[model samples]
Target: MRRPQLLHLGGRPRQHAEREPRHRRFCRSSVALTVGLLLTGCAGGVEPGDAASPGPAALPEGVAVEIVQLRADVAVRQAQVHIVNGSDADLEIGDVAVDDPRFVAPATRVLPGRTSRVPAGGEVDIRVQLPDVACARDDVEPSEPTVALGFTVDGAAGTARVTADDPLGFLAPLHERECRAAALAEAATLAFTGFMPAPTGEPARLELTVTPTGGGSATLVAVQATNLLDFGPATVDGAFPLDVTVAPDDIAPIVVDIPILPSRCDPHAVQEDKRGTIFDVRLTLAGDPGEIELFVGDALRGDILTWVSSWCGFAGTP
Candidate 1:
C-alpha cells in the first residue's frame, strides 16, 4: 500500500480558513452595530424633555423696541410693543418673551412657531397680554418700569431692556386723574398785580407775571378776556401779543392793555358794589392748545374796572 497517500490538501489548513470567515463576520457585525448607534445619536436620540441648548452668539444690529400703548379693562391687560427695524436688512422676529411674572401668553403664540417679518426701515406692533391683577396696584409716583425682552432678531437671539412710561395708569382711575391734575397745576403760576393807565388814552393796562412751575418749559401763545355778565369780549379778541417763553421755574412779565369802552357798562350798577364786575381770562399755551382758566381775583377785577371807568370819564351813578 502506498504507505500513506497522506498528502496535505494545500499550503493552508481548511479549519483555519473556516474560522477566519467567522471572525470577519463577527467584526463586520460589531462595526455595523457601533455605526448604527452613532447615526442614531446624531439624528436626535435626545429625549423630548431635554432642555434646549443656548443659541448662537450675537444679535442683529439696529433693532429697537418701545412700548407704544397699554390698555387694561376688566378682562385683560395688553401692551402694544413697537419694534423698529433700522437696519438695511429685513428682520425675522422669532419670538418675544417678556421676563415679567405679571405677563402671560399662550405657548402657541409666543415663539419658535410664531414669527413676524419686519421689512427694513419698517416697524411692527406686537401685543403683550398680562393679567388684570398686575394693573390693579396703585402707583404713587411717576415710575418708568424697565422690562426685559427676550427675542430673536434675524435668527440671532438677544435680550433687551425697555423703559416704559407711566404704565401704571391702568390701576385706578384716580391715578390718572390725579396725575393730570398735578401736571396742570404745575404747568404755570400766575400773579395779578395792580392796573395802571396806558399812555394811549383809550385803553387801560395791567401787569401779569407768569412763571413756569414744572420740569418743562412753557410757551404763552395768547390770552383772551370776556365779561362775566354778558360774555362780551372784555379786551380785543386778539390784541395782546403772547409769544413769550418761560423756562422751568422762571418768570416772564406780560403787559395787557385793553380798550376801556363804556358801551357795555351799566354806570348805576357799577356804582352799586352789589352788581360787581367780573372778567374771565383764558390763557392758551402752545403745543397744548387747550385753554387754561387764568385766575383774575375779584379785587383785581374791581381795580381794573375802576381804572377803566375813571379813564373813560364815567365815574358816576347813571
Candidate 2:
C-alpha cells in the first residue's frame, strides 16, 4: 500500500516541532503570502460563456446524446457514452473535443455513420487524457481532475465538462451502505471511550444507533476514524460478527464514550469540533436501498449521508 503523508493547511509537515524550522520558514512564508493574495481575486466572480468564444453549438435535430461513467483514477479518465437517433433519417456522429486550453481532448476514432437501421441502443467508449500543463501540481492533488467533452452530431456541436464533483468522493459511495455504517459507527464509539478521561481524556461517553429506512439484511465491511486534531489514541472492540441485520423501522444503538475536556469547552463545541477528522462507516443491505440516521446522546442530526453495495472491496458477492 502506498501512503503519502498529508501536510496541514498551514503548508508545513505535521509531526514537526511547534516552532518552524529556520531553513523551511522562508519557503512556507512565501506560499502563505501567495495564497492570501489569490483570495482577493476570488471575491468578484466572472460571468459564464464568452460572446467572443462561445461553447460548441447545439446538436443537430433528430440526434440525441448522453454521457456516462466519467471515471478516473490517479492516472487516467474514461467515459462510456450512448447516442440515440430520434429522427427518421440516419445521423452521423464524429470526434469530441474540448476547445479550452485548460482542458485536453485526445483524438478519437470512433464514428457512427449515417445509418438508421442500427438499433437505438448502440454505445461508445471515449477516453480523454489530461495534458502535462493542465495536470501539473506540487503537493496536494488537483481538485478538478476531469475535462469537458465537446461532441459534434450531424455537423451541430456542443460541449460538456465533468469535474470532481461529478464523481463520488473517495468515501461517499461506501457510507451509503447500512451495514458499513453500523460497523463504522461501532468502531468509532469504541475508540472514543477506550481511554480514561479523568487524567487526560474527556469525561463523557458516546452511543451510536442506526435505524434502517428499509427492512433488509446487511453486512459490515470496515470502520475508520482519524484523530486529525486530537492527540489521543483510538481503540476498537474484539472481533465480532460482520452480519448486522435490521428489520423494518428497527433502531440499533451502540453506546461509547467520547472523551471531552469539559473544563476547556462546552458540550456543543466538542461535538461541532470534529477537528477536521472524520468518522467513517461501511455497510451493505440485502434487499432494498435505505438511509441510516445517527444520533449522539439526546441530539440527533449527524448521519451517514450516502449508500453502499456488496461489490465494494477486493472480495464481493454477486
Candidate 3:
C-alpha cells in the first residue's frame, strides 16, 4: 500500500517516516468533507428572491365589535351593531354578512348601506335588519349572534368574522318586557268592570268579569300582587288560596278584596302623583297553569289608595 500523508498544523508536509496510518487520514478527510457539504446545503436551501415575497398580513389588533341593540317586532328583526377600531390605521368596513340567513342588511335611514369607514381609534355604529325568523324563540337558548365583517386594514382587504359576546345583557331584558306585554294583553280579555270600596270594618273589593278564552268553565286558583313602581311583590288579601269558579262565555263577576295593611299604604313612603304606583294583579286560572298579570292603571291605583287611606283612618295623610 502507498504511504499515507500527515497534515501539519502550519501546512507543512510530513515525511514518510512521520506519516499517520492510511485509515486515520481517510477518516479525518471524510469528516471534513461531510461538514463542508452540510454548510453548502443549508446555504443553497434559502431562495435569494424570498425577500420580495409579501409579509404575512397583520390581523385586526385591538378591535372591538359589539351588539348594542337587538330588537324584534312582529314583522322584522333588527340589530344595532357598534364597532370600535382600535388599530393604528383607518379601517374601511365593507359589506357585513351574518352566518344566520335571517339577518340581512338594514335599510333604515339610521344605518344606510355599507361602506362605513371607521377612523383609527374611533367607534362606529351600524344597524343590521334581520328576518322575523332570526328573532329569539322561547324554545331556543339565547345565543349571541355573529357576523362576518369585511374590512380593509392598511389598504389591504380582508374579512374578520366576529361573534358578539353580549356584555350588556340586552336579550334577557327584551324577552322579559315582551313576555310581560303578552301576559297583560291576555289578561285584558277578562275585562275589569268595577272597583268597590268596603264599608267600615270591611275590606275593599275589585270586580273582574272572567270570560275564558277556550269557552270552558274556569276557576280562579290564586292571585298574587306586584308593585309596579318598585317591581317588587305586593300584599293582597282574599286573592290567594282562591276557589272561585266562573261559567264559560257568561259574565262571571269575580271580586278580589283589597286589605287595609301597612304594606298597602305606608305613611313614610314617598308618594308620587303619577301612575307609577300601580299594582300588577297576577291571576292564576284553573285551565292555564301560568299566571295572567293585569295592570291596575295609574288612575285605578290612585283611587284604590285613596279608598284604602279612608278605611285605615289615615285619610289625607299624604
Candidate 4:
C-alpha cells in the first residue's frame, strides 16, 4: 500500500561580415547598414555586431512549454515536454531542461536520435525522465515551472528563459499528489488486504486496509479507473472516487472494500498490461487533497490478471 509518482531553428547565418544577414543574432552584428536594417533582433539592445551574445530571450506570449504525463508515462517516472508554438516562426530546439522547484533536480529532455523541433503554430512533445520530488522543502516558493531552452529563432542561435504554460495544469497536481501521498504515508499505511473474486464476470471486491502510523489524518476519497480495470458502476469515464475517512489514533487497521469490474475485453490489454491493475487512490491528508497510486503486488497482480481473463471470457487467451 504505497504510492509514488523542446525547439528547433533553421539554417546557419553568415557572421563577422560588414553586413550581417537579417535575423536574430546573439553574436556581434554586421556593420553594413543593409545588414543592420535586415537584422530583426540583436542582443544587448545595442547596434548590430557591437554587443555580446544574446541572452536567452523571453519565450513569446503564444509559445509555451508544460509538463504532461500520458497514461503510459504515469508510472514510468517520465513525462513529455509539451511545446505549443503559436508564434509566427518555427523553432529549432537544442538543449532543453526544466526548472521546477517541486522537483529535487532539473529534468532534461531525452532525444530519440534526431533533432527535436516545433513548427510554427504547431505542437510537439519531447520525452524526458522525471526528477525526484523536492516536496518536503517548506522554504521554497510553490511550483513555478520554467525551461532553460536553447533554440534557434529566425536562423539565429539563442537561449531563452521560458515560463512554462500548463493548459492541463499537471505540475501543481503532481506536486500535491506526491506531497499528500507522503503525508498520508507518514500518518498511515494503505495496502490491498485481500481480493474476493465473484466469478463469471461480476464485480470483484478488493479489500484495502488502512493502518494508522499515528501521525496525521486523511480521508480516502475514491479509487480512480484504469484502462483495463474499472470500479462500477464506474464513472461516465469509469471508476470514481470512493468516500471514506481514515482517521488517526486508530489502534487497529480499517479494511475498505473496492468493487472492481473488467473494463476491457481485449486479451492483448492484459497480455501487455502495464498499469491496468494498478490503482490510484484519491485522498485528503490533513485537508490537503492529493492522489496516491498503489501497486497490486506481483502475487495479487497475477490473480487479478487471471480473474480478468475469466471475467472477460478471456480465460486462457494470455
Candidate 5:
C-alpha cells in the first residue's frame, strides 16, 4: 500500500476560532464505535483434514471447515470465519457451536451459493461477547487445555469436532478484537487532517476533525510542525505554531485560518505554477494513546467524487 504524503502546517500563520454549537452533532455520547475491517481471504482452497480444518474425522460426514482469521486479543469484539467445501458432493452445515464456555460465536450461518457447494468457499462473522462471568471468574492459566468446535452437518448422524490449537489458535479472536479496540480508541479521539492554502490568501489554514469513543478524554497540544514542498511548486509554513486544545466531548470541525500568498516562477505558466504551489502540513500532537487516521477525498469537476482512508493512530495506541 502506498502511504499518502501529509503536508506540514508549520511557518503558516493561523487564526483560531471557537467551534459552533450546530456542528457538534458528530460526537455521540456513550455509543459503541464499531470500526469494521473486512479480512482478506487466502488464495486457493484450504487443504481438507488439515489442522486448520474445522471438522474431526470419523464423525459427521459433511462440509469441511477452515479457520481464516484467529487472534489472541479479543478487544476487537468481532471476527470473520471462512469455510471451504472439499467434498465431492454438496455439503451442508446444520449449525456451528463453540464448546468453550468463554468463546461466543455470534454469527454462524452458511451463505446462499457458497454453502452447500462442492469446491466452494464461504465465510461467517464470529462476534465475541465474552460474558462478565467468563472474563471475571475464569482463572484458566496460559498452559491449560482448551475446548473444540462442534459442527452439525445436515442429516449427519453425529456432530464433528474441530479441536482448537491451544494458546495461539484458540485465542486468535482476542487478538483481532484488541486491534479493533485500539483503533476505536484512537479513532474516537482527535486527529489532525493537515493544513491547506485558503482561497482568501491569508495564513495557511489547518483543518481537522475529532471523533470520540465512549471512554476517556483527549487534548491536542500542537508542539511542532514541519513544512514540505516536494510534491508541488508552492510552499507554506506556520508563523507561530503553538499548542491547540481539543475537548473530549467536543466532536466539532476546527479550522485555523491563516494567510498565504502563492509563489509563481514561470512567465507564461505563472497562473498554472501558482495553482501548483502545494505545501504539505505535518503536525505533531501531544495527547493520549491514539493515532491520526487519514481520509482523502477527490472530486472530478463536480460530476464524480470519492474518498479513501488510511489510519494514523494518535498517541501510538493504534
Candidate 6:
C-alpha cells in the first residue's frame, strides 16, 4: 500500500464540483431496438439496410479518450469521460460509457444539459457516476479499459466499443483511493460523532468516533485539513497526531476530542463549500497504509457550517 497521505483541495479550482448525481435522460434517435435496452435508456445502433438509417461513420482508429477523475468536492464518486473527435466529420454522439476491470459495472456518461456531439478536432466531456470498486486483489489496475461510444454518422446511429486511453493514468489512483477506503471500512467505521458551536475566536472540540469491525487492529495516523476547517492536537496549528490504536479485542469505541477552527474568513468560502465538512483521515493496519474520508451527518454538517459563518462573521451571523 502507498504511504498514508492527506487529500488537499485548497489549490484545486472551485469550478470543479459535483453538485448532485445526474439522472438518466433519453436521447431522440432512430436505432436498432434490440441494442437500445443495454444503453440504460439511451438509443442504440440502427440497422444496416433501414431506409431511414443514415450511413453510420466510423470513428478514427486512434480517438483520444480518457477518464478524468477529479478528487474534489463531494463528487468523489463522479468521473468525466473526455472524447476528442479525431475524425474530420462531425458526429452526433449518444450514450458514452467506460468499462474497467477494477469497477464492478460500466459507468455511462451523464450530460445534464449539453448535447453529446463531437465536432471535428473538438472534444466532449461527460460526467459519469463510478460504480462500486471491484477489489479482488491488491493490484487493482485494469489492464485495458474500454469505452462503448455511440455516435451518429451520416445520420446513421451505431455504437463502437474501442480501447479507451488513460493518458494521465487516473485509474490507478482511483483504484487506490476506493480500495483503500474499503480496506479501512472493513477494519472500522470513522465519523465525526458530534460538535458544539464555540464563541468567535475560541477553540471548539469535535468528537471523532472510531468503531472497530473486529477484522483487525488499526492505528489512526492523522486527520487531514479541509478548505474551511483546521485541526490539531490542541489548537488549529495542523499538528494533530492521532497515534491511537483500536485492537479487535477492544469492545468499546475509541473517542477522541479534536480541536478545530474555521480556517477561512471569506463569506464565499462557506457559500461555495464542497468538501469543507469532509475529514480525510490516514490510518495503518498491520503493515499496510491506507487513507479514508470521514463525514459528519447532515445536521452536524449544517451546524458546523453555521458555526463557521458565525465565527468568521459572514452574511449569516451567529
Q: Candidate 2, residues 1-318: lDDT per residue as tens digits?
A: 001112122111222133235224333333343343233222312125534545344332333333333212221222322233333433333344322222233323233221212122222233332222322223433332322334444344444332212222322232233334443343332222222313323332233333344444454433333322222243343111224544544455443334322222233333333322234433454543343322221111122100001111122211
- Write down the RMSD of candidate 3 (Cα, Å): 27.9
lDDT of 1 by residue, 1-318 (tens): 000112121111222233454334334333343343233313322223323734323223544444432212111223444454545776655445443322222211211345566676555555554332232233434343333444455455544444332223442342333333234445666555555554324545556666566565566555544332221254345334456666666644444443333334555534533222323233334455444334445566566556545645675422
lDDT tens digits, residue span 215-316, model 4: 777788777888887876656445565676656676578888888888888988877777786788878765667778887776777888888888888657
Please list the Cα RMSD from the true structure of every candidate, rounded to 1 decimal place: 33.6, 20.8, 27.9, 10.9, 18.6, 9.7
Instruction: Write the number of the candidate with greater lDDT, choosing between 1 and 5.
Output: 1
lDDT by residue for model 5 over 1-318, one digit each (tens)?
001112111111111122123112211210111010011111122235455544323322222333322221122222223332323332343334333434333233222212222222222222223322133224643321121233334433223444322312534334333333344454354333544543322334444444555454444333222221121213323322323444445565455433233222222222112112222222332343332212222121011000000011112110
- The per-prediction tally of clashing pairs is 0, 18, 0, 16, 44, 2
Candidate 6 structure quality by residue, lDDT tens digits, 1-318: 110112222111111122112101111111121132233323323445643655433454324555555434234566666555445776666666788888889976544334466666555566676778788854654575767766676565766665554544667766777777777767777878889778998867789888888877788888877777886335334546788787877668889888788877897777666677777787886778877667776677778888888887767632
| Model 6 RMSD, rounded to 1 decimal | 9.7
Structural similarity to truth (TM-score) of each candidate? 0.33, 0.27, 0.38, 0.59, 0.32, 0.72
Candidate 2 vs candidate 5: which has greater lDDT? 2
Scored by lDDT, the top model is: 4
Clashing pairs in 1: none
lDDT of 5 at 195: 49
Task: Please list the C-alpha lDDT of all candidates, in the order they appear.
Answer: 0.41, 0.30, 0.44, 0.64, 0.29, 0.62
lDDT by residue for model 3 (247-278), tens: 55555345544332323445334243222222
Candidate scoring better on lDDT of 4 and 6: 4
Off by over 4 Å in 2: 1-199, 202-204, 220-222, 229-234, 237-245, 249-276, 287-318
lDDT of 5 at 168: 25
Evaluated at residue 35, the lDDT of candidate 1 is 42
lDDT of 4 at 209: 85
Q: Over 4 Å off in model 1, which ranges?
A: 1-184, 198-201, 228-239, 249-263, 268-286, 315-318
Error of 4 at 297 (Å): 6.2
Candidate 3 — number of clashing residue pairs? 0
